[model samples]
Target: MLALGLNQFRKEHFWLYHVKPTDPTTYAAVGVILLSIALLPCYLPARRATNVDPMTVPRHE
Candidate 1:
């Protein structure tokens, strides 16, 4: 779902998309936008997450 949404968004916005196609500029713009959108989820923070202690490691005794 997320993948589809971001893809459409990129095509519409950054690409200045066209119906006939064959425009290199539009294609390049779309590609760049899609890549950026794909990376967005990896970098964004969770809405309700709290910071954990740096010194504490999980599953280690």
Candidate 2:
């Protein structure tokens, strides 16, 4: 829904940029890049946490 709104807004201001606001390739590329960026930090920590013993986590508290 937000993407649609942004796209509509961008379409209105389309002359300001080179690429089309509704381009699927650009949207896909950006979505992948953003998803990776968002997931990386979370994944790294969770991956590291999985290596620890469940009992050890309680001991620290």
Candidate 3:
């Protein structure tokens, strides 16, 4: 992703984001957004998995 971003954008870009430059807030926000996007979907399945009774899971013969 770092390499992809670097290749996608030019250095010293006028926008808030630039390939060569590093911004803590930018990275933090990006991390949070991506994490939310990713983890939100799995929350339901994760919760359900935790609630499942192992003994009730049917065993294949």
By TM-score, the best candidate is 2
Question: For residues 1-61, could you state the per-residue lDDT of candidate 2 as single tens digits?
Answer: 5776678755867646577776778789998999999999999999998999999889999
Can you write out model 3's per-residue Cα lDDT over 25-47, one digit (the tens) per residue? 66678789999999989998899
Order the candidate numbers by TM-score, best to worst.
2, 3, 1
Clashing pairs in 1: none
Q: Provide the global lDDT of candidate 2 against the true structure.
A: 0.83
Candidate with more favorable, higher TM-score: 2 or 3: 2
Provide backbone clash counts, one per model: 0, 0, 0
lDDT of each: 0.60, 0.83, 0.69
TM-score of 3: 0.53
Highest-scoring model, lDDT: 2
C-alpha TM-score for every candidate: 0.43, 0.65, 0.53
Write candidate 1's Cα lDDT for 1-61 as tens digits: 3544567555655445444244566667889999999977865654323465545646454
Candidate 1 Cα errors over 4 Å, as ranges: 1-20, 45-55, 59-61
